[model samples]
Target: MAFVIHMPLTNTKAATRYAAELPMRETSPGHYEGYYTATSNVRATGATVEVRAQDDYGNTASEIAKGKLNIN
Candidate 1:
């Protein structure tokens, strides 16, 4: 089965290192919901937050969601 997940932007800042541990919770069969803090600092003016997921069988998936913070 394929795993589905989503993360809404919780917070954001400019050029600062955003720190937050992703809290992934199993919501349903092959589905999860949580958030992961991006460890990398924002380098440019426009960049989206990306997340990756992997299953026990080594299957992997990724998605790029809108980041909550913006650097001016």
Candidate 2:
């Protein structure tokens, strides 16, 4: 099973603690793909974006992605 995940932005400031609410859509069995528009403006800094996936069987998986938001 493959899932296509899309994030609006992959950069955030160290002082910013914003949530990236992504609306996920199931494209196939055990697969999902969706894109989320950034609701908040993140400051220019280095930060880590964490992504988690939950299955119907209560199984959870997570991945850490790096982001660097430029603060104007």
Model 2 scores a C-alpha lDDT of: 0.50
lDDT of all predictions: 0.48, 0.50
lDDT, model 1, position 30: 66
The top-ranked prediction according to TM-score is: 2
Which 10-residue window in model 1 sums to the lowest lDDT? 1-10
The global Cα lDDT (0 to 1) of model 1 is 0.48
- Candidate 2: tens digits of C-alpha lDDT, residues 1-72: 122233334455542334344556678886766553444563434544456777789887777656543343
Q: State in Å the error of residue 23, model 1.
A: 9.8
- Give per-residue CA lDDT, model 1, range 32-51, as digits (tens): 67643433552334545555
Task: Give each model a TM-score.
Answer: 0.36, 0.41
Candidate 1 lDDT at 25 equals 70
